[model samples]
Target: MTVAQLSPQSQVAALPQTWDLERRHQSMRRLVDVVQQLSLARSLEAIMDIVRVAARELTGADGATFVLRDRDQCYYAEEYAIQPLWKGQRFPLTACVSGWAMMSRQAAVIPDVFDDPRVPADAYRPTFVKSMAMVPIRTEAPIGAIGTYWAVHHEPGQDELTLLQALANTTSVAMENVRVWSELEDRVDQRTRELDAANRELESFSYSISHDLRAPLRAIQGFCQIYLEDHGDTVPVEGRPILETVVSNTERMSALIEDLLRFSKLSRQPLERHTVSLDDLVRRIVSAQRAAAEPGREIDVAVGPLGQCEGDSSLLEQVLVNLISNAFKFTRGRTPARIEIGRRSDGDEPVWFVRDNGAGFDMRYAGRLFGVFQRLHSAEAFEGTGVGLSIVQRIVQRHGGQIRAESAPGEGATFSFTLGQGS
Candidate 1:
């Protein structure tokens, strides 16, 4: 019932002090136990049960009910009366006392239900409820209400009202926590399903490349080689050049497909991390590059002490191979191409770098450097599939690292990266 509707005599009628000091002390101890249990409750149903029992015990009431707001209805979701009273009942927001308490955002203490005009008399006719006290679960915007009832006309005092309000406040927090945790679990499940679907699609694509694409490429390359060797003299000299061009293009296509497959595989490959000597890995790549260089080409490579890092050894080796090879490819015209491999600290983490005197790119287009099949120079000037940097970036990212480059047109470039503490 609204406070304004109460008669002057009933409003100030003092409630009898039935609870002694010892009874109040026992109530306080029970309230503390209920609060502790509320924190471990995982569901709204469980929280409601705890609140229902706690409210009855703390206020020495004959019955207690937990009411939740459901749109335009007040739902008696749970009840703990000595004899059942509206255990699974629902009423219109305007017709129920619980709804009125929530709508007014205040507690209702009715000493005599039959004397109050706001009481729905017919609903209590079959039950023994003669009085009730209801406080909204939340103060500012009530989501629900906690109610206590008596079988006889009994006035509830200020202490009993205060105890019920504290229990309602704790119930609100527990319910909100359960809702937020449920939402987070649902989001995690959705993301996991999405990742599973994407992986299946990728596996299908990879299978198609390995079988369908490779079959046609292998046939073309084999036929071209047979034709050039078996019947070279039968064709006109001018026409022979066209046949050679076709063979070269087919080889380049095969190389491009292989690089694409490697790039795709990186996403699914699990990292096998361990301590790797960066200095040793760089030296091995440089040795391989020098052995494959043209006879007259001269290149000066300086390998310094690169501190060890924890990462997948094979993947780290591939990163060094790609960066060093790019340096060699871009510095084709330099009489004595200079390349340096070293590492230095950046206060928090060690930053390893590959510096080269080569054909550096414009800083404006550096954003596109790590994209697959993106190239700054034409094929005629420098031949490449342009998938190397993309692969390097993915490997570094998988290791929880960051990579960036500094460069300008005509000036040389430096690529640096940091791999965080190992997982």
Candidate 2:
């Protein structure tokens, strides 16, 4: 990281046998360090800060100017100098040496600024600059220039010119990288805003639908209940079955509406994270299921070493309740309906699962398992609102996790989930 050292008398030293090689090596090291810094530069200000200092140190220049093209003008944006030159000034592109370098797409080497007609003599009269070398920032369709100045008449060597151009080339690439990243950030921000607006609209629509639909459904249920209670004997024997059918359908419809509302509400629910013991949770749910089981319906449930996780206790409990309940329902009529709750490792992820040896579904329809109101088994065979898995999936996803199912007809089904970061 050593910088090239020049004699106090001259900024650009002659090729002396004593220290020519050593100085060149130091300059190369400095260039490498500057290139590394430019790679991480995310803005124009950062690029200019690195380039301005490196330009003076690399060439032993008395001063340096970082010029940027502003349409047909050359802007003296930044500078590192012993004396002020043009720190914040603008001039016509055709009137400045840096502009000429950009326009010609080559380095401009002037040994005497006063003698050169292209050099603005009026500007240099006030500064200590007697000679200068300017290189375009980009060779093809140049965007700017880097200029190094000397107090005395001195001509730059091929090595100095080459190093300066290399810096400019790297600067071009760095600017392009900054532009690409800025555009990407803008696009991501725009998409995020759009998604937020859509989610808000959907929440409003779902709530409206829930309220509007539930009122009529409650009315129907109330009228059916009154008819069954007060007018049961008045109805003929054949009409009694029809009346019962109407009541059953109304109850099923109410269950479906409740489940639908629950599924919709889950999307907007804020998760409250807490440490949860899967073993305790599963045992409690299984105990309740056992207590609720019909008399003489022998059921055997095994609780395995289910681990713990960080998640919403209420939402996660709902997940387990729905999964375990489905296992209990599907395993009905078995000699001893068996259900197992356990944990397993899939690669680096820990998966928790609820398994049943009851009636499993075909694997081909597995994709539809988490969809609302989608069911493989009919309501008559296995009664359900069919929104359980969808709600389970929403909760798991809110915990930054995923849920999946595997099953084969008459072989049983296993539902597994992972609570990624929460785990």
TM-score, per-candidate, Cα-based: 0.69, 0.85
Model 2 TM-score relative to the real fold: 0.85
Question: What is the C-alpha lDDT profile of model 1 across 329-411, one tens digit per residue?
Answer: 88788888988888888987898989888889999999899998999889889888888999999999999998999998777
Kindly list the per-residue Cα lDDT of model 2 for residues 176-273, writing each as its tens digit.
Answer: 88889789989999999999889878867877787688888778878977998999889899998887888788788878878878888888889888
lDDT of 1 at 113: 88
Candidate 1 regions off by >4 Å? 1-67, 70-100, 103-105, 110-133, 138-142, 146-192, 199-203
lDDT of 2 at 45: 94
Q: Which lDDT values do the candidates have, in the order given?
A: 0.88, 0.89
Q: What lDDT does model 1 reach?
A: 0.88
